[model samples]
Target: MKHPRLFLHVQEPALAAQLLQSAVVKRFIVVKSSDAAPWSEQLLQQSCDLAFIQADQHSEADYQQLLSSNILAEMDFIFVSDGNPEPWLDKLMRSGAGYHFRQPLDMVCILDTLQDFYQQLSSTQQQVKANNSMLDQFGLLVGSSRSMLKLYRTLRKVAVTEANILIVGESGAGKELVANTVHLASYRAEQPFIAINCGALSPELVDSELFGHTKGAFTGALRDHQGVFAQAEGGTLFLDEVTEMPIEQQVKLLRVLESGEYRPVGSDKCRQANVRIVAATNRDPQQAISDGLLREDLYFRLAQFPVVVPPLRDRNDDIVGLAQHFLAYRNAQEQQQKQLSTATLQLIAEHRWPGNVRELKHAVERAYILADKMIEPDHLLLEMALADTTETELNEVPAGVPLEQLEKAAILNTLEQNAGNKTDSAQQLGISVKTLYNKLEKYQQTEP
Candidate 1:
């Protein structure tokens, strides 16, 4: 909010100059790339607020470059054009641009489109006057790391839209929490936010679970039942582990998503599905699609606004802070003065939380329960400590394995260390037994 910075990367020099020189845009700290080169690290570190880029092949190339450069996720681009909304509109939207304004360079119109954005920035600056505040910065999530900040930018853009959102993250990365925050930030906040785990549902009852079943549809259908779609009418339906849904049910779900109409089991009448969908998966979606776990069409429909939640390992900067937050929360809840010992803090900071935030939170809670005044590292029961103290094998990956393969290898090795005891394996890995089972099941299906 400190003199809102706006970068103009329009293809036309005159249009860029016109927008730059306009009195209406004078309130912004307008910056044009001196040589109109690709955005450098220094420029992004300074945090550009708004960007106007020409919607053409050149801009598309530049946009892809920014994406490859890892800066696209942190940016909010407003594609500008001198013509109709053809050819590039779909491409732009798919690339995450929320607005595509036809240009002859209308300054007043630009201001109108950005009025809310400006005020929102000002409001956020005022509310988060210190180092940062969690709720003010991002919905329900704590941290000011670059990845979290990138996530916040994505959330703010997509939350207001009616499109279905697909949240991708590793297990325990808090996908459901992210989905809940998106729901709370949206217009449907006051309405019911129903959640269902597609993987947990009985495969035979999957359809009924999603679209409800009429009376006498099955042996247990004593009366007509409302499924998640009906239960979340006019609100959001959060579909956790969506990739695990039966293929047949995925077909039904995709039909409903595309047509907005669904017929209940054993019912002739079609019901309107007035529900927003927010789905999440722990798997690599492309891998799932390749393995026939998730339908590509359905994935496309669900991922109108795809949100990638950063793994805990990727958010190293927020590790200790998040642990402290959990400790403080527990202290508040139990009316006790408990604190983490310095050594414990170091352990929390160094260990790679493969189980992500959920693991960290659980570790802190376990420590809180085990300790009196000062929580020590032993209270954490972390895998690293077990490996150091016992003959437990380290989570070693092959020299050239893909990044996605590391977690699976770690899980298998842990399960072996615990003598195939699922619960013990899951505990050692800092994940739920269910998550461990799910990963195992998924792996079992893929082995040749």
Candidate 2:
């Protein structure tokens, strides 16, 4: 998140200079006002989180006018003065003046107060979620839960607009599917839909992969390669795990969004883009910005419409229905009427699916394989918590369990936890992505 903005009405030069140099004050966006400019006029113009006004310095009429300013309703006010504010405390509190303080200020307590004020602001912002709306199906999504219905309702309105969309959700909550739904439900339904995982690409290749490269652009440029934008012209482009994109690459993306134009690498020729941009991240957008994983400016440009997909835990009511849907597809392939046991259904309802829908689908697949007539809870691996599945398996291994088998299982489980994000999987395993890729290839070759 961007730093909380403070409207610091500085009257004393020494305190202003001290505040500017202090480490405590550097945490905020401080906007100083010292001249005789009306506080109400200035407050009306800029968006501020907190207003520190010298209430006693002005006349009673000026104080009353400041309190009457409509902007104060949206802002938290801390009235400052050298005199006692006891007489005006009741009236000040009624007008949204949350705090009052005398001169010889305690800067130490100020930081703690700011933290509390920030929390209040954060709580208000989180009050508007999609769970209050309604719908049963939209594109590839299938769920009867309130959040799923709300998501469907949100997507319907979002798809009509040409503005960019940002989808935020936990891993395996089907953000890409939501992006596809946005495309399919929009006027661009018949157009190409291109999807790429930002985390899956290396830093050096991001530019070439995104904007295309002309033949002989670099040493390994065998032929001209068309990028996602060119391939997805007049369509939709889904960027998954966008927070994992390098900070430098984010600048290029911001430029494209602003201008709707880009030049292929090594070619001076510029191209206009007709593609709709849709980005997704498993992390909170505000936290990602504060952590420097995502750019603030780019975030505002892309998050014109943000759709948050509900995690499986929040939509547990739909778990059985989704499992049956997956099983039906698998059963069709096997040409058999396979079914889940009552115990398996009970376990599915009770267990917390930390990895969300992807983990649930994988569990269903495993159950299908292990059971001939009826899939049981033992086959689902729901006995242990989803987060502990890998650790439990590792700890309970028999004496003769092969190291290669254990290693493969750990790698596969980690990959599932990350929703098949190879870069993240590699990082978690403390191995290079090249090694991870090699092992995956070996697993494919050796599998019976």
Candidate 3:
């Protein structure tokens, strides 16, 4: 009564009848002929949960035909192979069979195995449903541009393995998006994905934030804390702006990467950390090393599988697609739909997006909020990009300007504009709040 129906693809009448006698199998379909293809299709159409295919009872031709049929595609196949099951079991498993059993089945063992299989099948179905729901909400990466295609291919290749990845690009270059895609495609998709910015914390606080600390480790340490490493165990730990980590902390981080072990500050016991590190840095790590900002050894350790996320400016062909994508995203967030005009898209494509995808995203968000009807070129505000340059130059300069000064100016402007709200300033700047604090500290130290 537990299972309403079960299908048995067995030519042996005695075995079929004995199996049907079980209290769980209320309804049964027994295939007694080699040409039982129509029955198989009918069983599938009827939504049979389990299919027992007896290899010994059926002819080789019949087995081959069933295996090749589309009816078996969605079904969970339980193959009952003969005594020496190595060859047949291998073939069946490779051909998408879920479970296998040897001949001369023990009733007790068969019942137990079926119960376990039912539980597993239910769990798998639930997981697939959840995944489909998430995909529907997030939407797939939708671009056919050569750069996007290349990035997609690379992401697929890297997702199957366990390796440290370093995503390098200028700010707004979609580094985090790439990291998410890597996680989604990887074997650890079901595991926790925790992201932290090394550039966001001070040298004194970065260690405790990453590896945690015991109670009373520092002035305000209230209780024993589980840092990002512990939180990201068996999953991914995405370190954004890794080059911003102070040199001293980099040495400790390098040790953790090499040994897969770390201890909380003011604690003697070492904890195992099985996190996959995927670091992203806008700064040139090699240059950072040369400038005595980042440790070279740490850079090498983190760069096990380095990937450069191309800047938006470099992928001009993807602009329209990305713009539409952003507009759709904004529309969903604001609960209103909008479209971009051809002239509007053309203007967007013409600009030099020094801030990269982050800048483009901000642009779209601002336009969405401000536009009364259809989004036009005039509705777009390039002030975030323009604030970095002088008003005269912003109007006169035909070519693009250096981004470093622009970035610095933009950061300062946001800080002042937000009344020193570091979190909001960081959000507007497209950098971590920790990075904003670091910049503030740096500015104070060198202030005249």
Candidate 4:
């Protein structure tokens, strides 16, 4: 593993000198604040892995400004103070900083702590790399897009709390996955996590499924059945396609969320609801409320923390990463080692993933199964590619237009249509994805 790049924000000359010559200093690449330049600037100038800040030395305003800027978001901060940190610095530690080192610098102790921290950081990075390699399966959802990363951060914060969450996204965008992630991240992780699709069941059964039924409650109700609310006690109950719930059921759900109490279908005795509620839907919550599909009052009650899952089209940077991850995952599962060619990667990157991550994964898997050692562009059966090139063959290029320019236009046009999915564009152009990438690379060289 590479050594960590570190920043020292110690303002005291003697302490700074001590830290600079410390045993831990030899383990990392450390940059100290030399002049009046902002610590964030110094840190950003290079790829910093971690930072040690003398929180007590900085003013409250300076500390707050540093935090508000979010300059240290990607790295861990270790605060060193002469004594207990000031209230504001303590709050900072509570907010996100991992460790605190008290003053009267214990070099040996500091080195040991630093070693432990490095080990942990290295382990976490490896896990993230592994997760990214798989793409679709990471921290409950697979995505590296800005929207997805923001969603992950939000979930991490909201998970430890008891707040209800509303996940709004398109179908197959992994709303239930978000719910599961929250549950697993929370203190209730050891308990059960029960999920029920509100759209999949009838109105009558929806009530029974969520709240359970007593013995002989209805026809074929032989024994008492624990409802999802009870089954998910001490954990979470994920309500999928929540908009599909009947108005009457919505009222009950709202009541349950509000009072944390519910009744079985046949039993009058009310049971305490210990499970956290996580509701999700593909439809717009506001539109659903306008259409009377979702209760307006219940919408407010469930949306304690609303998380919107971005569609595949909106996450352009994540397409290739997710596609490759899907391919590797398939190879692992089926004992096959198929890989995507460079040209194919470009096509995959260019195509608009209308179905989002779900569509991308399925498409990659389909192509992987058909290809030999390398999954070429043709293996990716994109309908848009076939439709685009049906009339314009390569040899039928119009006169006066340079052949290279025409080829570039065709490639670019196909890419635009497919929303930058390179796999589809390459397939449509009757070329390998690698060849398409090469041509584009050469065009960039000539054009630039």
Candidate 5:
């Protein structure tokens, strides 16, 4: 509700008084300046939101002082000059003036210009507030590695589209962060962005939870409920660990995707949903389909635009940046400033981050709480040697294991954990079913 402050500088006291008579300029301070030097100095100290300077009969020293004032950087200035503004207008604009007004200025036009300026300023302030909130809450993905840069570029491009995105990556790889960035950048940014973990729910409950259910729909259906689809109307729904969704639930999800309509569990009436779908998994979905754990059609539907988020170990260059980012965040929370030691950074870079970003975040938080001053190498508790063992064991065979064999094993492990569902598996793996299938086929062919 705060109004912008406008300062008017004029050499003619009569004209300045007349301009002040206008309702639009009534709130402004009109100054009759003999030279621009005093006005320029005052402009630098005062929080002037906008400035109106009369350019008719101005001294050369006044012009020089006005041009050199640093206040111009923060204030939007308009020049009121007699005669045509053809030549000087461009110069004023280049010198940071907002606009140029010729002589015989209509009061109505001045009012309209002021209104427009305020409106634009309000809009810009809102945008800046929103951007700052996003950065404060979500922070950057925090990586300078080539793989991370590729992921960042891909995320930016994908955010502009309204496609059904399928994110595939290992557990703890910040899949949810990617989902958040997409929602923040997308057109539906002003709407709700809801995230649900499919693997956390049982097969029987997932249907009711996702599609909603009516009172007496099942054992615990005390009352009618709105599902995630309904809750995320006109927004986005992020389904995490999607491959864990049961085969029955997958069919229901596919129907929703295809028709944009879904019925509550115990209700026959179908409701419309205008929601964007973005699913993530840390498991290979293609292997789930080959193993008869996932449906092929559903896999393709959710993978309209598939993006793979690389793990932390794979993007080594992002370690220091991410570590520093987390450290700063923790420092802010604790109200205590602490820096990470060089040795700690080196150790962190050398260690294989199996848990990915989530794990790294937790580790930093823990270190911040435990360490009294600087975070040293000893503060980090990562098991370096055993980091790749799980992935390696999943890849090995009796003697010579084919690439496809390893992929199938990885997929099967994820499917079993997810109870034989591909959507949830793909969400867990953080890769599209298309990519999952490519690995599946490659592994199948290597079966001796």
Candidate 6:
């Protein structure tokens, strides 16, 4: 999930600095505004999840304009005051305000307020998922849920444009499939579509891999090789888990995006790039920027159009259809046909599917291999009931436990459950393997 963006319009420099230093503030992507520039302009450009406005400093006209604006209709607002409540409070009573905080702010209270805000926001998002007619498949993508249909509509609109795109979703939500759909739908369909996993490559080799290298560029460079950018010229380059890109490589990529030209690792001459970029990441893009994992400039450049793929659990209605599709595809490949029983289909739908669509595909394939003719519930080889119970157990925690500690425990437990396989654990956790490795590294440093 991407971190929520909060706009800070506080006028007092000292108070702004104090809030900026708070640990809880780090959890959000904050956009701080200067007193000189109009905060409304910032609000217009960025879709903020929350806003912290100083009620005392702003004029009545400013408050009235804000109240009339559509920004208040969508995002949550929290009013900040140094002392007693202002008389302007009467006008904002009708606004969908979240909370009010007075000066000498209690960090604990602020943290608690944010936790509740996020919980409410999550619930609201789930409820707002669009409802549409079912679809078994769209291009190569699967799922008939409302979310899938909405995504298809978005793809149709975005594919026609030459604009760069950013695909955000949990692991195994088929981000690659979405990228493929975009490439096929675009004007560059005749050109090659090259896909690269940014997280899987070594940091030292990233530059060479993306921009090509001359012969003897490095110790092992025996021959000249074309990189992804050159190979994908006049086509589309899909960058998966782009947030895992090395910081230095990010600078190079930013230059390419800005100027449409790049130099090879060893060469002085620069080559022009005609390829389109379609990047994907399992982590929240805004959070990645806030955490210093991704460059802010690069994020703004790539995310010209952002499409978020819905997870399998959120599309429960499509589980059976997807399972059957996988089973049929498997049978076609091996020349052995099988059918799933009604009870087995029910069992598949009931499962939480923590690993999303990829997990479901694997489970279905396993059942197809194990079964002779009719696939039963046990043949599916999925622990539906136990997993459902475990899901609940995982969500609950004892009081006074810090959020970071719980997150670490979840990561460690998931890693152990996967037998220390970083890839599997990351998939189950809906994050990238690189992110999992980073967390492990942090834990290692902190261990006493």
TM-score of each: 0.68, 0.62, 0.58, 0.65, 0.56, 0.59
How would you encode candidate 1's per-residue C-alpha lDDT over 1-448 as one tens digit per residue? Answer: 3466777666577777766676656777777665644543334555687776676644445555455554555667777776764544554465555687775667677767666455444423322322322323466667656587667778876787788999999877878779888999988999999988776677788888888899999898999999889999999999988988888779889999999999889899999999999999988999999999999999999997788999888887678878887777778777998988999999999988777776777678656655679998877767543345453332231245565565765575464345335567788889986687677657544521
Misplaced by over 4 Å in model 6 are 1-135, 384-448
Runs with alpha carbons beyond 4 Å of true place in candidate 5 = 1-140, 384-448
Cα lDDT tens digits, model 6, 238-290, are 99889988877899899999999988888889999999999999899989999
How many clashes in each structure? Answer: 0, 0, 4, 18, 26, 1
- Decide which is better by TM-score, 2 or 6: 2
Regions more than 4 Å wrong, model 2: 1-136, 383-412, 416-424, 427-448
Q: Model 1 Cα RMSD, Å?
A: 10.4
lDDT of 3 by residue, 1-448 (tens): 2332356776568767766676544333333334635444545455555677666633455455556665444455666667664554465565445667776777677766665545333312111111112111111344444465445545555555676888888766767767777787777888998877676777778878899999999899999988999998888999987877887788889999999999999899999998888999877878878899878788788886678878777777667656777787666665776878888889899988666665665566556655666988765666443336467645642245456544555575465445334567788778887567666556434421
Residues 1-448, candidate 4: write the lDDT tens digits: 5566787788878877877877767777777766667665666675666778776545576567655765534566777788864877765665554577886878677777777546434422322554228332346677656566556656765677787889998754667678888998888999998877675567768778889999999998999999899999888999877888778889988889889899999998999999888999888999998999999999999897688888887888678888877776677776887889999999998987666665666567547645679988876666544354555443343356656554555565566456545567788779876576666546434520
State the weakest 10-residue window (summed lDDT) of model 5.
Answer: 127-136
| Distance from true location, Cα of 8 in model 3, Å | 40
Put the candidates in TM-score order, highest first: 1, 4, 2, 6, 3, 5
Computed on alpha carbons, the lDDT of every model, listed in order, comes to 0.73, 0.74, 0.66, 0.72, 0.67, 0.74
> In model 1, which residue pairs have backbone atoms overlapping below 3 Å?
none
The C-alpha stretches of model 1 lying farther than 4 A from their native spots are 1-30, 33-49, 52-73, 77-137, 384-448
How well does model 3 score by local distance difference test?
Answer: 0.66
- Clash pairs for candidate 2: none
**C-alpha positional error of residue 427 in candidate 4 after TM-score superposition, expressed in Å:** 31
Off by over 4 Å in 4: 1-126, 129-138, 145-147, 384-448
* Number of the top-ranking candidate, with TM-score as the measure: 1
lDDT, candidate 6, residue 137?
51
Deviation in angstroms for 301 in model 5?
0.2
